[model samples]
Target: MKVGVISDTHGLLRPEALAALEGCALIVHAGDIGKPEVLEALAALAPLRVVRGNNDLALLWAQGLPDVDRFEVQGWQVLLVHDLADVPAHLDQGVQWVITGHSHKPLIERREGCLYLNPGSAGPRRFSLPVTLALIEVGADALVPEIVPLLAANPLKATSR
Candidate 1:
Protein backbone atom coordinates (compact mmCIF):
# COMPACT_ATOMS: atom_id res chain seq x y z
CA MET A 1 0.00 0.00 0.00
CA LYS A 2 1.17 3.51 -0.68
CA VAL A 3 0.40 6.53 1.50
CA GLY A 4 0.68 10.16 0.45
CA VAL A 5 1.79 12.55 3.21
CA ILE A 6 1.56 16.34 3.04
CA SER A 7 1.55 19.33 5.35
CA ASP A 8 1.59 23.08 5.98
CA THR A 9 -0.26 23.91 2.82
CA HIS A 10 -1.39 27.15 4.54
CA GLY A 11 -3.94 27.67 1.74
CA LEU A 12 -2.44 26.74 -1.57
CA LEU A 13 -2.49 23.19 -2.89
CA ARG A 14 0.09 23.19 -5.58
CA PRO A 15 -0.44 21.26 -8.76
CA GLU A 16 2.95 19.69 -8.23
CA ALA A 17 1.91 18.35 -4.87
CA LEU A 18 -1.25 16.78 -6.30
CA ALA A 19 0.68 15.26 -9.16
CA ALA A 20 3.18 13.66 -6.79
CA LEU A 21 0.45 12.05 -4.71
CA GLU A 22 -1.44 10.45 -7.51
CA GLY A 23 -2.25 6.73 -7.16
CA CYS A 24 -1.70 6.61 -3.41
CA ALA A 25 -3.81 4.35 -1.19
CA LEU A 26 -4.17 6.93 1.55
CA ILE A 27 -3.26 10.52 2.44
CA VAL A 28 -2.24 12.18 5.68
CA HIS A 29 -2.31 15.92 6.20
CA ALA A 30 -0.35 17.23 9.19
CA GLY A 31 -2.11 20.61 9.14
CA ASP A 32 -1.74 24.40 8.90
CA ILE A 33 -4.20 23.99 6.06
CA GLY A 34 -5.22 27.68 5.80
CA LYS A 35 -8.45 26.91 4.01
CA PRO A 36 -11.07 24.16 3.71
CA GLU A 37 -10.46 23.85 -0.01
CA VAL A 38 -7.08 22.29 0.68
CA LEU A 39 -8.73 19.39 2.49
CA GLU A 40 -11.36 19.15 -0.19
CA ALA A 41 -8.67 18.88 -2.81
CA LEU A 42 -6.78 16.17 -0.94
CA ALA A 43 -9.92 14.25 -0.11
CA ALA A 44 -10.75 14.09 -3.77
CA LEU A 45 -7.53 12.16 -4.35
CA ALA A 46 -7.87 9.52 -1.63
CA PRO A 47 -8.86 8.69 1.89
CA LEU A 48 -7.44 11.47 4.10
CA ARG A 49 -6.71 11.93 7.78
CA VAL A 50 -5.75 15.32 9.16
CA VAL A 51 -4.95 17.09 12.41
CA ARG A 52 -5.47 20.72 13.35
CA GLY A 53 -2.52 23.08 13.49
CA ASN A 54 -2.04 26.03 15.87
CA ASN A 55 -2.82 28.49 13.11
CA ASP A 56 -5.97 26.58 12.24
CA LEU A 57 -7.54 27.45 15.59
CA ALA A 58 -8.49 30.98 14.61
CA LEU A 59 -10.73 29.77 11.84
CA LEU A 60 -14.27 28.71 12.67
CA TRP A 61 -14.42 26.03 10.05
CA ALA A 62 -11.26 24.37 11.35
CA GLN A 63 -12.30 24.41 14.97
CA GLY A 64 -13.67 20.90 14.78
CA LEU A 65 -10.42 19.37 13.59
CA PRO A 66 -8.64 17.21 16.09
CA ASP A 67 -5.30 18.13 17.55
CA VAL A 68 -4.13 14.55 17.20
CA ASP A 69 -5.17 11.46 15.29
CA ARG A 70 -4.21 7.80 15.40
CA PHE A 71 -4.95 4.97 13.05
CA GLU A 72 -3.41 2.04 11.26
CA VAL A 73 -2.07 2.06 7.76
CA GLN A 74 -1.20 -1.31 6.28
CA GLY A 75 -1.04 -2.64 9.83
CA TRP A 76 1.41 0.06 10.91
CA GLN A 77 0.11 2.24 13.73
CA VAL A 78 0.49 5.95 13.04
CA LEU A 79 0.09 9.18 14.97
CA LEU A 80 -0.73 12.41 13.12
CA VAL A 81 -0.16 15.88 14.51
CA HIS A 82 1.06 19.33 13.49
CA ASP A 83 3.78 20.09 16.01
CA LEU A 84 6.21 17.47 17.24
CA ALA A 85 6.68 19.37 20.49
CA ASP A 86 2.97 19.11 21.24
CA VAL A 87 2.97 15.33 21.09
CA PRO A 88 1.75 13.83 24.30
CA ALA A 89 4.28 12.40 26.74
CA HIS A 90 2.45 9.10 26.53
CA LEU A 91 1.58 7.40 23.29
CA ASP A 92 0.21 4.05 22.38
CA GLN A 93 2.93 1.43 22.58
CA GLY A 94 1.80 0.10 19.23
CA VAL A 95 2.41 3.31 17.36
CA GLN A 96 5.19 2.70 14.88
CA TRP A 97 5.16 6.05 13.08
CA VAL A 98 4.75 9.66 14.22
CA ILE A 99 3.83 12.09 11.44
CA THR A 100 4.13 15.84 12.03
CA GLY A 101 4.69 19.13 10.26
CA HIS A 102 5.14 22.62 11.70
CA SER A 103 8.64 23.82 11.04
CA HIS A 104 8.11 23.41 7.29
CA LYS A 105 11.31 21.40 7.03
CA PRO A 106 11.20 17.88 5.65
CA LEU A 107 12.39 15.07 7.92
CA ILE A 108 12.38 11.29 7.83
CA GLU A 109 14.03 9.42 10.67
CA ARG A 110 13.85 6.40 12.89
CA ARG A 111 14.67 6.26 16.59
CA GLU A 112 13.97 3.75 19.33
CA GLY A 113 11.87 1.67 16.91
CA CYS A 114 9.55 4.41 15.67
CA LEU A 115 9.68 6.41 12.50
CA TYR A 116 9.22 10.21 12.52
CA LEU A 117 8.21 11.91 9.29
CA ASN A 118 7.51 15.49 8.26
CA PRO A 119 6.29 16.24 4.73
CA GLY A 120 7.39 19.91 4.70
CA SER A 121 5.58 22.96 3.29
CA ALA A 122 3.76 22.50 0.01
CA GLY A 123 2.14 25.93 0.16
CA PRO A 124 3.72 29.36 -0.31
CA ARG A 125 7.51 29.00 -0.37
CA ARG A 126 9.08 30.21 2.85
CA PHE A 127 12.58 31.63 2.98
CA SER A 128 14.46 29.18 0.77
CA LEU A 129 12.85 25.91 1.86
CA PRO A 130 11.99 23.61 -0.98
CA VAL A 131 8.36 22.59 -1.25
CA THR A 132 8.02 18.88 -0.60
CA LEU A 133 5.96 15.92 0.54
CA ALA A 134 6.60 12.28 1.45
CA LEU A 135 5.34 8.97 0.16
CA ILE A 136 5.30 5.84 2.30
CA GLU A 137 5.24 2.37 0.82
CA VAL A 138 4.14 -0.38 3.12
CA GLY A 139 5.63 -3.77 2.47
CA ALA A 140 5.12 -7.08 4.22
CA ASP A 141 7.84 -6.34 6.76
CA ALA A 142 9.02 -2.75 6.65
CA LEU A 143 7.94 0.71 5.55
CA VAL A 144 9.78 2.70 2.86
CA PRO A 145 9.60 6.49 2.88
CA GLU A 146 10.56 8.89 0.10
CA ILE A 147 10.64 12.67 -0.05
CA VAL A 148 9.27 14.34 -3.20
CA PRO A 149 10.11 17.94 -4.01
CA LEU A 150 7.68 20.14 -5.95
CA LEU A 151 8.85 22.86 -8.26
CA ALA A 152 6.78 26.01 -8.66
CA ALA A 153 3.52 25.17 -10.41
CA ASN A 154 2.84 26.74 -13.76
CA PRO A 155 -0.88 27.41 -13.81
CA LEU A 156 -1.11 27.90 -17.55
CA LYS A 157 0.60 24.60 -18.33
CA ALA A 158 -0.06 22.59 -15.18
CA THR A 159 -2.18 19.92 -16.82
CA SER A 160 -0.14 19.00 -19.88
CA ARG A 161 1.75 16.28 -18.09
Candidate 2:
Protein backbone atom coordinates (compact mmCIF):
# COMPACT_ATOMS: atom_id res chain seq x y z
CA MET A 1 0.00 0.00 0.00
CA LYS A 2 1.21 3.48 -0.77
CA VAL A 3 0.47 6.06 1.96
CA GLY A 4 0.93 9.80 1.65
CA VAL A 5 2.00 11.70 4.75
CA ILE A 6 1.77 15.50 4.99
CA SER A 7 1.81 18.13 7.70
CA ASP A 8 1.80 21.76 8.81
CA THR A 9 -0.15 22.99 5.84
CA HIS A 10 -1.14 26.26 7.44
CA GLY A 11 -3.86 27.26 4.94
CA LEU A 12 -1.84 27.04 1.75
CA LEU A 13 -2.13 23.69 -0.01
CA ARG A 14 0.35 24.14 -2.77
CA PRO A 15 -0.45 22.55 -6.11
CA GLU A 16 2.85 20.72 -5.85
CA ALA A 17 1.77 19.12 -2.59
CA LEU A 18 -1.41 17.82 -4.13
CA ALA A 19 0.48 16.51 -7.12
CA ALA A 20 2.93 14.61 -4.97
CA LEU A 21 0.10 12.99 -3.00
CA GLU A 22 -1.64 11.70 -6.08
CA GLY A 23 -2.23 7.93 -6.26
CA CYS A 24 -1.77 7.33 -2.57
CA ALA A 25 -3.93 4.59 -1.07
CA LEU A 26 -4.30 6.65 2.07
CA ILE A 27 -3.37 10.18 3.17
CA VAL A 28 -2.39 11.22 6.66
CA HIS A 29 -2.42 14.86 7.67
CA ALA A 30 -0.53 15.65 10.87
CA GLY A 31 -2.34 18.97 11.24
CA ASP A 32 -1.84 22.72 11.59
CA ILE A 33 -4.20 22.62 8.67
CA GLY A 34 -5.27 26.26 8.43
CA LYS A 35 -8.64 25.73 6.80
CA PRO A 36 -11.41 23.29 6.03
CA GLU A 37 -10.91 23.65 2.30
CA VAL A 38 -7.53 22.01 2.66
CA LEU A 39 -9.18 18.93 4.14
CA GLU A 40 -11.73 18.82 1.37
CA ALA A 41 -9.00 19.01 -1.25
CA LEU A 42 -6.93 16.26 0.34
CA ALA A 43 -9.91 13.98 0.92
CA ALA A 44 -10.65 14.31 -2.75
CA LEU A 45 -7.37 12.57 -3.48
CA ALA A 46 -7.69 9.63 -1.06
CA PRO A 47 -8.95 8.39 2.27
CA LEU A 48 -7.57 10.77 4.89
CA ARG A 49 -6.81 10.49 8.60
CA VAL A 50 -5.94 13.60 10.56
CA VAL A 51 -5.08 14.94 14.03
CA ARG A 52 -5.74 18.50 15.08
CA GLY A 53 -2.78 20.74 15.81
CA ASN A 54 -2.55 23.51 18.40
CA ASN A 55 -3.37 26.15 15.82
CA ASP A 56 -6.54 24.32 14.90
CA LEU A 57 -7.95 24.59 18.39
CA ALA A 58 -9.45 27.99 17.67
CA LEU A 59 -11.18 26.99 14.48
CA LEU A 60 -14.84 26.03 14.73
CA TRP A 61 -14.46 23.50 11.96
CA ALA A 62 -11.64 21.77 13.77
CA GLN A 63 -13.45 21.43 17.07
CA GLY A 64 -14.39 17.84 16.48
CA LEU A 65 -10.98 16.73 15.30
CA PRO A 66 -8.93 14.63 17.68
CA ASP A 67 -5.49 15.36 18.94
CA VAL A 68 -4.44 11.76 18.44
CA ASP A 69 -5.49 9.00 16.11
CA ARG A 70 -4.54 5.32 16.16
CA PHE A 71 -5.00 2.74 13.47
CA GLU A 72 -3.45 -0.28 11.82
CA VAL A 73 -2.38 -0.42 8.21
CA GLN A 74 -1.00 -3.53 6.57
CA GLY A 75 -0.67 -4.99 10.09
CA TRP A 76 1.50 -2.14 11.31
CA GLN A 77 0.08 -0.14 14.18
CA VAL A 78 0.28 3.58 13.57
CA LEU A 79 -0.16 6.56 15.87
CA LEU A 80 -0.68 10.05 14.59
CA VAL A 81 -0.13 13.23 16.54
CA HIS A 82 0.57 16.85 15.65
CA ASP A 83 3.35 17.40 18.14
CA LEU A 84 5.93 14.91 19.40
CA ALA A 85 5.82 16.35 22.90
CA ASP A 86 2.15 15.46 23.21
CA VAL A 87 2.71 11.79 22.38
CA PRO A 88 1.31 9.64 25.11
CA ALA A 89 3.82 8.33 27.61
CA HIS A 90 2.34 4.86 27.58
CA LEU A 91 1.99 4.03 23.94
CA ASP A 92 0.49 0.77 22.80
CA GLN A 93 3.17 -1.89 22.53
CA GLY A 94 2.42 -2.70 18.92
CA VAL A 95 2.60 0.82 17.57
CA GLN A 96 5.28 0.70 14.88
CA TRP A 97 5.06 4.23 13.59
CA VAL A 98 4.60 7.69 15.08
CA ILE A 99 3.82 10.45 12.60
CA THR A 100 4.06 14.07 13.68
CA GLY A 101 4.53 17.66 12.50
CA HIS A 102 4.82 21.24 13.89
CA SER A 103 8.47 22.22 13.52
CA HIS A 104 8.41 22.52 9.74
CA LYS A 105 11.39 20.21 9.50
CA PRO A 106 11.26 17.04 7.46
CA LEU A 107 12.70 13.99 9.19
CA ILE A 108 12.82 10.20 9.12
CA GLU A 109 14.31 8.24 11.98
CA ARG A 110 13.88 5.01 13.89
CA ARG A 111 14.15 4.92 17.65
CA GLU A 112 12.85 2.60 20.35
CA GLY A 113 11.48 0.21 17.77
CA CYS A 114 9.25 2.77 16.10
CA LEU A 115 9.72 4.85 13.00
CA TYR A 116 9.17 8.58 13.45
CA LEU A 117 8.27 10.70 10.45
CA ASN A 118 7.59 14.40 9.96
CA PRO A 119 6.71 15.50 6.43
CA GLY A 120 7.79 19.11 7.02
CA SER A 121 5.62 22.04 5.92
CA ALA A 122 3.65 21.79 2.72
CA GLY A 123 2.11 25.22 3.33
CA PRO A 124 4.09 28.45 3.21
CA ARG A 125 7.87 28.20 3.12
CA ARG A 126 9.50 28.28 6.49
CA PHE A 127 13.03 29.64 6.77
CA SER A 128 15.18 27.68 4.32
CA LEU A 129 13.40 24.38 4.88
CA PRO A 130 12.42 22.64 1.70
CA VAL A 131 8.71 22.21 1.07
CA THR A 132 8.16 18.46 1.37
CA LEU A 133 5.97 15.47 2.10
CA ALA A 134 6.49 11.73 2.50
CA LEU A 135 5.43 8.61 0.70
CA ILE A 136 5.45 5.31 2.57
CA GLU A 137 5.42 2.02 0.74
CA VAL A 138 4.01 -0.65 3.01
CA GLY A 139 4.66 -4.22 1.99
CA ALA A 140 4.20 -7.49 3.79
CA ASP A 141 7.75 -7.37 5.14
CA ALA A 142 8.92 -3.78 5.38
CA LEU A 143 7.91 -0.14 5.11
CA VAL A 144 9.96 2.06 2.81
CA PRO A 145 9.69 5.85 3.20
CA GLU A 146 10.71 8.55 0.77
CA ILE A 147 10.81 12.31 1.30
CA VAL A 148 9.83 14.29 -1.78
CA PRO A 149 10.78 17.90 -2.23
CA LEU A 150 8.07 20.10 -3.69
CA LEU A 151 10.34 22.73 -5.14
CA ALA A 152 11.41 22.16 -8.75
CA ALA A 153 14.96 23.17 -8.03
CA ASN A 154 15.39 20.58 -5.26
CA PRO A 155 14.55 17.62 -7.49
CA LEU A 156 13.00 14.40 -6.26
CA LYS A 157 14.87 11.85 -4.14
CA ALA A 158 14.01 8.85 -2.04
CA THR A 159 15.08 8.37 1.56
CA SER A 160 14.80 4.79 2.73
CA ARG A 161 14.66 3.20 6.18
- How well does each candidate superpose onto the true structure, as a TM-score? 0.91, 0.93
Task: Name the top lDDT candidate.
Answer: 2
In model 1, which residue pairs have backbone atoms overlapping below 3 Å?
none
- Model 1 stretches astray by more than 4 angstroms: 152-161
- Expressed as tens digits, the lDDT of each residue in 1-161 for candidate 2 is 99999999999999989998999999999999999999999999999999999999999999999999999989989999999998877778898889999989988888786888898889899899989998899887677888888885454444444
**Candidate 1 local Cα displacement, residue 70, angstroms:** 0.5
lDDT of 1 by residue, 1-161 (tens): 98899999999999989998999989999999999999999999999999989889999999999999999887888999999998777777988889999999988887677888888888899999988888888875788887788884421111000
Model 2 alpha-carbon drift over 4 Å, by segment = 153-161
Q: Which candidate gets the maximum TM-score versus the true structure?
A: 2
Candidate 2 Cα deviation (angstroms), residue 124: 0.2
